[model samples]
Target: MIRGVLEMGAAGFLPKTASPEIMMGALRIVLSGGVYVPAQAIASGSEMVLDRLTERQRAVLRLALKGMPNKLIGRELGLSEGTVKSHLSAAFRTMDVRNRTEALYAIAKSGARI
Candidate 1:
């Protein structure tokens, strides 16, 4: 459901169990043009999860985070576009996200250096 809401373009999601301060913080983040995800939804120890990414996957995500299209990322990395896509797909899975936007939110929430 959280993924569905995010996929539908919702700016944030707060579980009903969230405290008032947390709800307020989420609202502030959304108002500031950021996506808000509950910590549990992003998973604990996300840095370790990030570490599981292959170096190629990390390279792809670094380029993707820069807003590069897959084709451009491929050209820069000397990979085929299909290979770029594959790397991104694997990265998303490692990050437990369904797409690039969710991946970005998860990365931010995790406080990982990337």
Candidate 2:
């Protein structure tokens, strides 16, 4: 009841077991400047499943995807190999992944590849 009240306070309304017709009605109400959510719905948890990353992390992911060795990537980016490693490590953490392959895969899936 508290949750329902909270949602209602936010200007949204919904039924726990709405039929198709009720769903359409809710949509129409929402379209007319209301917010709609199912009663069973709760606030979304973990908006960011992955940690935020820096530009360097994004750069490292891009370079890794191009099959660039760390050393070469460092040279191209005008960074030291150790710096490249640091960026990649951060990228791995931000992507919630391990290893270059996983980082690359995550980047691709996230449409962050350059």
For candidate 2, the C-alpha RMSD (Å) to the true structure equals 16.7
Give the poorly placed runs of model 2, Cα more than 4 Å off.
Answer: 1-51, 111-114
Give per-residue CA lDDT, model 1, range 1-114, as digits (tens).
776787688877789999999998778766755577775665444375788999899999876764567888899999999999999999998788888778867675666646
Per-residue lDDT value at 106 in model 2 = 40
Score residue 29 of candidate 2 by CA lDDT.
48
lDDT of 2 by residue, 73-92 (tens): 89999999999999888877
User: Candidate 1, residue 48: CA error in Å?
Assistant: 3.6
Total backbone collisions, model 1: 0
Q: lDDT of model 2 at residue 16?
A: 57
| TM-score of every model versus the real structure | 0.61, 0.50
Give every collision pair in model 1.
Answer: none
Top candidate on lDDT is 1
Error (Å) of candidate 1 at residue 5 is 12
